[model samples]
Target chain A: MQFLRTVLTIARKDLVIEARSRELAYTTLFFAISVVLVFSFSFVVEGVALTDAAAGILWVAIAFAGTLALGRTFERERQADTLKALLLSPVERPAIYLGKLVGLLLLMTVVEALIVPVVGLLFQAPLGRAPWLLTGLLAAGTLGFAAVGTLFAAMLIRAHSRDVLLPVVLYPITVPLVIAGVRGTASIFAAEPNLAMAQAWLSMLVFFDAVFLTLALWVFGPVMSE
Target chain B: MVSVDDVSRNYGRRRALARVTLQAARGEVLGLFGPNGAGKSTLISVLSTLLRPSSGRVRYGTHTADGAGDALRGHIGVLGHDLFLYGDLSARENLAFFGRLYGLDDLDARVTDALRLARLSDRADDRAGSFSRGLRQRLALERALLHQPRLVLLDEPFTGLDDDSALVLIERLRSLRERGTIVVMATHDFDTAEAVVDRAICVDRGRAWPVAAGAGTLRERYRRTLKERG
Candidate 1:
């Protein structure tokens, strides 16, 4: 119960800061929309079919945009060395990771909420057909992405080249989630959506999220300490 | 009581602290004075459990920092060079956030009292980003003391404070000492050290020794120590 309270307190603190600044949400949303628009324009083919292109574009936009959000989120903690202050607190390190993951998830979810419709409108894809499945895939993929992303972001808070290093390190490890997300999203966006294939990809996403989140939780304390 | 036994810390090839031993009892204010790279802040970091000693250990009574882990941190309040308060949050919100993190009961009351203590009650609703450096330092002090920690670590607490504000802070440190809170302050300001410290030590080149007795003043003792070492 105390752990949960700590998690909520941290999450609330991040959310409150974001709410006041509106920096992360606005920047992430704008970046996501921009990515979608650029991709939509580029992926147009005169004769070639664009069946799976929409799924690829949507997931790529989210992945890229999510990185932006993660950077900014950790940037706030880095300012004034607030992350060190948080580390000095009695709260469990896993709780801190979980709290940051939830905050990132929420911010990414808001970006998706805005970007999904834009993707649909621009790509002429039917994202509204299976709203629930799409939500599950997005949630599962984002959880996995954030679980690992938060750890690396914190680990690199003091790194000299953190901005360049974050994506360089993050993208390789998150390949499985991206592959699963793109495949699952492509399956859902199929003319006659393949439920079984989508479910399989979703399962892969869920498994990766669980394994990485537990690993992240276990390593956070030691990695964060001197 | 807090006991640091031969604590030494290093970063890469540079040694920050070397075989430094110190102790502070309840109701005592221990001042650590040193030159720019003298490792006073390093020792404070070790005591605060933010940095682990490369060799040796620190003990709070019978429990070591390794054994106590997060629980040890609960009893510590640190005001380092970094303010630690979020600039976007109002002063009240920053206090309330830290109050909840410390799991204090009746949080609203505690936050109210903290704001009043920092003399920031009038500007409690304003964002910390808008405050002057002295005001920010005051609010940071309030945040550190929100839970009434047993051990308070202040690193250059007077960095941005005006003379009047510094005196106000000194009085507060005295009050904490009277309340049996152990205070360890690291600063270059010898005057503040002379004003409040029960005992002062001059640390140089990673080693520490007590400021000599019968010395003219902290400033004189410190200069003499540095000259002798040279």
Candidate 2:
């Protein structure tokens, strides 16, 4: 019960800060929109081609924008040495990781909400056919991304070139999630959406999230410890 | 009581703290005076469990840092060089947030007391980003004390304070000592050290030894040590 309270406190703090500033949400949304627009113009050889490429473009945009959000999210903690302060508290380290993961997931979900419709409009992708499945796939893939991303962001918080290093360290480890996300999303955008294939990819994403989240929780204490 | 035993910390080839040992009992204000790069902050970090020593151990009463773990941390309150309050949050929000983290039972009342203690009640609703350096330092100190910790560590607490603000802080330190809170403060300012500290230790080249007299004597000793090391 205390653990859950601590997690909620941390998540609430981040959300409150984000709600007031809206810095990460606004910037990430704008960046995702820009990425989608650029891809639509560059990749659309014809209407059919645009629809086919939509999944890749949408996921890639989320990946790029999600990375930015993760960096900025940790950057707030880094600015006033707030992360160190958080570390000094008696709360469990994994709780901190979980809280950050939830915050990142929420921010990424908002960006995805905005991006999916924009992608649908611009590329003529079939987003309405399988709304629930699409949401599930996005959630699963983003959970994996945030699980690993939060860990690396905390690890590199004090590194000299953290901004440059975050993406470099993050992308390689999360490639499997991205692959699963793109495949799952592609299936959803198909003329007759392959629910089974998307489900398989979704299952893979869930597995990845569970395994990586456990690993992150296990390693957070030692990595964050001085 | 808090005890540091033969603690040594190193970063690569550079040694930050040598096998330094010290002890502080309740109702005492122990001042750590050192020149820059003399490992005062590093030693304080170890005491606060923010840094693990490369060798040696820290004990709070009978329990070691590892053994005590979260319980030990719960009794420690630290105000370091960085103001740990989030700039975007209002002063009241920052204190309330940390009070909840410390699991304080009466969070609203505790936060109110903390705000009054820091003299930040008037500006409690304003964003911390708008606070002056001195106000921020005061707020940080308040945050450290909100949990009613038994052991308080302040690293260069007087760095940015004006004379008036410094006096207000000194009074609070004196009150903490009177209440039997073990206070360890790291600073180079002899005047401030002489004002509040019950005993002083001068550290140089990663080692520490007690100063024989008050701030004036300690100042001379520190210069002599620096000259000898050069």
Candidate 3:
């Protein structure tokens, strides 16, 4: 119950703020649209190239937009020095991580929803068999990215070149998720649509999400407090 | 009661607070007097369970401050120079938000009471980002009081307040003390310390001087010691 309250409060505050500003949603959607538009114009969408390249382009959009959202998750709090207040509360650190994860998931899902239709219309690519499989993978991938990004973003905010440093630090560690996400998308988009192959990527996503989230929670309190 | 024994902290080669010891009973408001870099913030951070000491220990009731000091933190409230209130949230929303974190019952009622004490009930719906320095300080105080904590560690709580706000805060501190809450405030201001805190300790070069009974107030003693030490 304590953990749930912590998650809810943090997530609620973040979502409320995002709702008011609409920056997270707006930026994420714009970025996703630009990614699809740029790819659509750059590649010939009339032939097999459109179908063959859809999964890679889709994962790239998710990864890139996910990074943008997670990067700003704690910027306002850190800037206004409110993170100290949050830390001072009795809620454990892991709860803070989970709360941020949920907020990021919500925003990332919104961006994904926008991108799915855009991808479908622009690329003439179908979501294919196991559509929910695609959503599940996207959710897991977003969770992994958000967990690692939130932790690193907190650290980056303390450094000299935070904006430049955030992506440099984040993108490298999150490569596994990007790879798994693409492979997961590819499995669903493939002709055979093999369950075992899709499950493997999904399993990696889940495992990565669990591992990074636990570690991020363990390290977040000390880093943010400092 | 809270006790600190030989607590010290270091960052690489720079030692912040070195082997400082302090003790305060319930209801006693202790003022820590120090200039910049006197390790006042570091000491407060360690006691408030925000930072771990490189050496020594702190005790709150039966709990040790090293590993499980978090249990002690639950019973304490901290208001640092950093307002620590979310700027986007309204004054009441900020209070309500923190009140829930501390699991306060009737969170809205608690927020209402806090805003009243902070004299911000009229501006409860105003974003904290729009507040003046004095108003922000007042709101931060309200945030600290939302949980009705038994212990409070304040770092420079009087920095940005006007005379009226200062007086209001002193009155609030006195009431908290009357209710048996231990308040530890670190400040560079003697007049404010003289008005609010009962016992005062001078922190210099990372060591806390032994508090002694003297004529005048704790602030007077603190100024005299700084001069004498110099």
Query: All models, DockQ values?
Result: 0.88, 0.89, 0.64
Compare candidates 2 and 3 on DockQ and give the better one.
2
Which regions of candidate 1 fall more than 4 Å away from where they truly are?
A: A46-49
Clashes of each: 0, 0, 0
Q: Each model's TM-score?
A: 0.98, 0.97, 0.93
Off by over 4 Å in 3: A45-51, A155-157, A190-196, A217-226, B66-69, B210-221
Q: Which prediction has the highest DockQ against the true structure?
A: 2
lDDT of 2 by residue, B1-230 (tens): 99989999999899999999999999999999877888999998999998999999899999988887887899999998998999999999999999888889989988899899999899999999999999999999999999989999999999889998889999999999999999999987878667898888878879988776434465786676556654
| True contacts recovered per prediction | 0.93, 0.87, 0.69
Give the better candidate number (1 or 2) by DockQ.
2
Residue-wise lDDT of candidate 1 within B116-218, one digit each (tens)? Answer: 9889989999999999999999999989988889999999999989999999999999999999999999998888668999988888989988877674988
How would you encode candidate 2's per-residue C-alpha lDDT over A150-193 as one tens digit per residue? 99999999999999999999999999999999999999898878
lDDT (C-alpha) at residue B99 in model 1: 81
Error in Å for residue B196 of model 2: 0.7
Q: Is the docking of candidate 1 incorrect, acceptable, medium or high quality?
A: high
As a whole number from 0 to 100, the lDDT of residue A18 in candidate 2 is: 100
